[model samples]
Target: MKQSKKIAFVAGVASLALLATGCSSSSTAATGAEGSDATLTFMSTEPKSITPQKEPGSQIGMALCANLMEVNSQSQKLEPLAAKSVTSQDAKVWDIELQDGWTFHDGTPVTAHSFAEAWNATATGSNAWQGNGTFVSFKGYEELNPTDGSKASTEKLSGVEVVDETRLRVTLNAPNADFPKLLSTNPTCPMPESAFEDLDAYEQSPVSNGPYKFISWDHNQQVVLEKWDGFKGAEGFSGGADKLVGKIYTAVDAAYTDMTAGNLDMIRNVPATMVDKAKNQLGEQALYEVETASKQQTLQIPEYVEELKSPALRRAISLSIDREAIAASLLKGHAQTSDSLVPPSLGSYVSGSCADCVFDPERAKKILAEDGGFDGTLIIESNSASDQQLVQALTKQIQDNLGIKVQLKPTLGTELSERRNSQKLDGAVFGLWGWSYMSPDQYLSQYETGGDGNTVTGYSNDKVDKLLRAARAEMDEAKAAKLYTEAEAIIVEDLPAIPLFIPTDYGLQSQCAQLNDVQGDLQYYRAGYGC
Candidate 1:
């Protein structure tokens, strides 16, 4: 759910490349008054799809549709948004009751059927929606999306049943206490009947029920939204901006320049090269930076690499890199050195879950020698321009510390993703994972054998697989977290991927607007505007 270095990966499936989330304003009108008309603009890359279920993590989708559940920005707790309540007795069967009077932008009523139909369409294998993996636990998901790549036997999930216009019942394949957390995702948002009538047309101008409504989409340029005055949710238009405009820019530097010139209102990602200068240039009030809960930078090593399969060799490579130095000097303190696979934002995270993650060149060299030293060059691949510096720094550290020739290969994000999907990535790949919700399961589930996120690394441990499964089914919140923590211990021991850093989410605001804390999805929502 978290945006990758240059793209968003939904349940480990790579989607379109997206810019970091931030909003800017083109209008200079002082419009913070109760009903004053003002436009707030934001930086974004062109979205592949605006449909909520099709591209759940899209900034456009997040703005246009209200999800069943949303994370409280301050508390970081999952709470109801569109849905009045999500209740279950056994955690396997859930009943969702929608808040009455919620309507789509097109004036159509949002009902239980709206959610069921949208979910069914997303689950259908023939549709090939990237968000399909989110519904794997729903009963009949296998029939809808067969792993063998054959035609699906069913189009709808048998577990999702509309009890009435306002209520829906869902039965999962297993008891999952974290099921409610999943609802907070954009994919779970309800769709209007008009969307199903002609999906392609709907994608172009989606009829959503959120704080904003679709206005126009200038492809490769911008997508515009007007505040939906009929929004029934408790949170709506806090910024007082009448229009939310997402201006697509291929370069972050350009956006930052525009922001500095006062032409743009806000920007979520300050170019890595300009991170240090941003505070001095914009002042402390205008610059916002916080440790993100959903992001973790890592280096993934495929198990199929015979010469590097040894856990000791992998551990040595991890130890060789100086994460603290890179985060402080190279990244300008924009990132935190990570010791565990899970970020500290999650309650399940243990401070020192990854013992091998520490930097110890001597120990690394000793381990490499004991495990039969690696022969030949260690190639680390990355596609993102933002990650190039970090990747290069890592290669240098590995070479200097471990005494192995290291190469940093820069490829296009799309090409790198293809190689990852095909499991053809050779030595090591620099990547990052972002989560849509605040849950430890999002981080740990990727290592499960034959799991959605396991396609790239091909690292599988029977104990880890079992632990993840149990964690998914465990009803007790603390128990589920413990299981995930235990699994992380084994995963670090295996060293399929080395946790490197937890980067901070950065934003710059103009004097005209106020920015809220970055949401779990790593997007900055407007809290207020019109200074």
Candidate 2:
């Protein structure tokens, strides 16, 4: 799960106040020829921050800080990056050994204390960092993130301990064979000492230990990075470009236009409207597509909503939608109809796991009648920034098939997030659940009682919770996957959310750039761009 940990909000126009008049530096444009000192420009949204923990999966942060582990794009397996080795016996207590000679951009050594202190600051409830949820598995996390909403007793997580200058130990509250895989996520990346001294200033332009060092951030215009000549790490870690430029854009369509015009080196998440024309316009070699395991569009039904509490009603809703048609038509075949909540790219996936997802309008009608017909219009809320055409199609399908009056509420992304966080949503909402790591637990664990990622849908089951716990502790990969599958089976029956579609990630590469490696689930930073 190399994608952003934040809810997969639909890409929308960035704030108008942050908009730049035009792209700066004509030299940054794609040259259509390889140059040793070339600059690669990528289309990107305005980043909220450059801090790894604060903005996990941010391209700027990914380029600025090297993580303890990285996912091999081809194998989809974890590999050591900053860390020399991450080992655990019983999957509970782990030891981490850092690679020698790795130094921060500020020229300070990236010692074990750098990681321990950073984790402590992120875990502290007072800090309220977005990445705090990632540290919940560590021992003594409760003391740092108290549920009572009172001040924490201590800022440090007792589980994180520095063994020496290069070695560190981590003790989780429970066994998790995927702990090392979790380290591959950006939130687990270490921060230098200067970050702790003044977090705000560090966030503006932080010191990091990645292949690229931050050069400048031009607010909403662009972020410039220069290759760190002194970078030392595993082979193939260094980038080909002398400089990388993340050019901020208010809209994806505009980015796609620039990419086709040869002004941009690479652009991801090609707009649904442009999906069909991209390959024809840019040629097949320039358009890249891959099935993504990290995220899926879903219709989340909160249990608190009295009208939608019945499982039969929810199942009927799922059965009503023609996912295949929607995927082919509205999405322009850029998405795959999801049969289960889990995407097919993961190991735990089982085809046709979501039996209710089948499109059978007569069965849906009968089930809806048996479950007692709705008294009022069904409202489907979604972020306006999302794919409204797909939303409109879904609403139309439900209205036509189920014979129920429906309303589509397209709210702003920020306002929608605020309403969701406060549990103030008036009806079922369309959203996405993205994983922090490449594990089934990332998807199934949300069904656990009061789980950290369970903010969208208030779903809970005793059997599912027990199965998830068992999966977490199981060291055997196959056994763990079985336990997770069992949990997913139960969740599918409960129908807390309707799995709509697993989108195929799409990107366009400029004629000047050649992608050495492409990972659909990860941000563009993970790919090697030779320009």
Candidate 3:
């Protein structure tokens, strides 16, 4: 979901990159011997901010902050990182023990106080950090959000107690089985106290506590990181690469060209247009079609759009579109048709496939007619150029099959996000929605009443809300899975948002390092040495 979150806010800074001239069509890769000398250059969209606690989590954020815990891509289980071990009973009171000798890029020792200070600052309202919402489960975290329009009540979180340099205790407001998984997020990554000294400057050129240290950040251009010899993650993190460089490509075609020329060691989220060609050009060894838990694109109908609020109408709309055709022709068979809101990466995931997900134009027409069929154009909003393509394809299919007038409206991601958050958007919006971690709660909780992820659909179901709450409080994994299954059933029945495709990541990587799945993302850190 970090990629989706990044896309949701990219409109604010995309214009800058769009305005600037493109980089050299083909650049030279840093040539040197193997190991640390072997640098990996990546071409991706620029991250809006890299501030550890405040910025939207993205690949850039992941590169900079080593979280308290890390998720194994293959197993979808938690692995200790900064915190050597975490123990919790009753799913509320948790004790964390940090691994000794980890240090910030600036050579400052990381401690329990570092995390406590960072999380408290991030949870405060005055900082305007988007991550504050993630910590609402912590006890006394409510104080960080003053009911009044004043600054946060306190900088010190009553929930977080630093017992000593290596030990800390956390108390949550409610029992949450996924609390440890939550700590794996970038927002929860600890930052040195000095990060607060100049938040703005720090965001542009932040120090990291990860395997790589920040070297330079050329705004709107590129970010450079080099292996930190002092980094203690050698035992469990990173591969043979000594340096990692992330650069912005004004055009995907340019990125593809650079990847072919070996200027870029890899390029994530490969453009659909180039997926097939990339596979052929890079050969099977280099091309990777990594499956992700991202709900890449979804068709959302807000409750405010009165005409489309009927459950029957929503189902009709969902059934009218041919998802398989879209995946085959438009996506070039690189996409997975998603029948459920939660991706199939988590242990509790269900396909949610039923008569509701099947494509049947006649049945759809009958449902819509019975529901007193529409007379107006359905306005579908697209947040990005890629999304606009998908929206355009959907509009054609929905209009052709349902005989409903569909209008494709393109808008900047930021503007659309604003409209969504304020509950001002009507009709439908086809955009990004995904999970950042491997938990059903990440997807189910969003459907809770007034949840941030529910912005597009404005969906509310008492059964779903109650089931999600029960799942969150459930200490047993099996019980939680059952609760999630029940909640998912309720949501798919409501049909507020129609799942389109489970996102896929396509990239070309040299054998120098193998790609490892980390929480559904195939990242370089987990790569094994080869080339």
Candidate 4:
């Protein structure tokens, strides 16, 4: 269940090895109390990589590095972190001023140059960082990853104007109203020159500027990070523990066991089925429901499938699946049946609610009958056993409601992604792999004509494309939100993608160690502050 760069969005489909073993009752874990030197042991599903700019979105990377802006998990608001201030009169041009007296774990002064170098390297084709999608907004992004098969001509981005040691200017390719929110994400966190000097070594123990500094990483075992005494961030003043030690767990059930028994300080991603059980057994105070960035389970209906091309048939299929039933029965109320592609937790939430999204077996059957009844077997593939189980439940509902023959195929997570990317599947594909950012632009752009998340499904609409482009270029937040909402309404009606539910993080935290759920990411540092 190790986290991978590509597999992060596999939707909560982890193998929960539920062995009939008694829980261990150990109470010798360290608490995040002020003036108490403690090491918080966290049970983590291992990250695929810890390299900055390469796998910066990984949980390990987020825990170690401090970005220009820090997003409040609850509010989804961007606050200044490394940058003292970020100002923009025109959305395309932004001036970023770094906070004075901030230093990496290795004692290197964090400068504007550090960010420039890290981003430029990631954008370059030779680096092949999977996170390069984060930097596409940069002015010279296309030059770094040229479509013409030419080598990158520059080391520094033309849009980034270095003002001084503590200041720089960023020029986006187009006006993006949510540019500040983009900078707040972990992938945009600055990396010291030391990381670029020896990429492999940095991955092992990256010099960090956050509340915690990387100490050591034992692959597939544990990653150790100690509190930096010289840390000057706002989170540093808050009551954070002395150290963070992430112990890798192969299964969520085992991690949950350890956490409940007090052997581990915290365990993330408790299985959905176990939510009620954990809450009852461990007490509500011990159970945490963390709001993660909007990860909606969706069915990507490929355009290649002729039978699925019928709007009425697709609508029938969508209505046939009982999302609320699955959310309550299978998910144990851990998720909500989603109406819009954009989760309501975000800023640009659009209420795309419709009668079409409502489950009506009789209406669905009538619709299918009108569209020349779906007689062929509909095959759906998923990565994990849990997801397969969920799909099986949905397929059963489909068969009973719409009288459509359905098949559920289970594949390895990586294999599923490969098949999805290659467009090898003749049927529909389902996954949690969508936008990590809170922007409506990121959400809607997935279905844009030949966009990054669009190529697999070949789902496109001219109206949707026009609206997305306008939103992308709009400097006003209200105008962009309106445009995105208009586009979402069109897509929701067409039924190119069927939204099932929005994913929420359910976990357990010991009384000794606080669990801070920041924008869906569980953090021990925020627990220290009791925010």
Q: How many residue pairs collide in each prediction?
A: 4, 0, 1, 3
Question: RMSD per prediction, one decimal?
Answer: 7.8, 8.7, 9.3, 9.6
Q: Which lDDT tens digits does candidate 4 get at residues 93-197?
A: 888888888888889898988887777777676676656667777888777766687888877678888888988899987776677777766667778888777
Compared with the true structure, the alpha-carbon lDDT of candidate 1 equals 0.76
* Most TM-score-accurate candidate: 2
lDDT of 2 by residue, 1-531 (tens): 433222111111221211343322222332324444567889876776777887675777877878887754434445677887877756788888888888999899999999998899877867756567678889979999777878889878999989999999999988877787788777787898888788889888888888789999998799999878677643234445668899987666677778777789887655565677887888888876655546788998888888888899888889999998888877887788999888887778999999999899999999989887776888999877546778899999999998988899998655676576557888899986677676888787667875655666779899988898889888667988898899999999989889999887666777655443423454555445444
> What TM-score, computed on C-alpha atoms, does each candidate reach?
0.86, 0.87, 0.85, 0.81
**lDDT at position 81, candidate 3:** 70
lDDT of each: 0.76, 0.76, 0.71, 0.70
Ranking, lDDT, top scorer first: 2, 1, 3, 4
Off by over 4 Å in 2: 1-36, 73-76, 271-273, 291-294, 304-307, 376-386, 411-426, 432-436, 450-452, 516-520
For candidate 2, which ten residues in a row score worst on lDDT? 6-15
Q: Show pairs that collide, candidate 2.
A: none
Mark the 10 consecutive residues where model 4 has the least summed lDDT: 6-15
Model 2 Cα RMSD, Å? 8.7
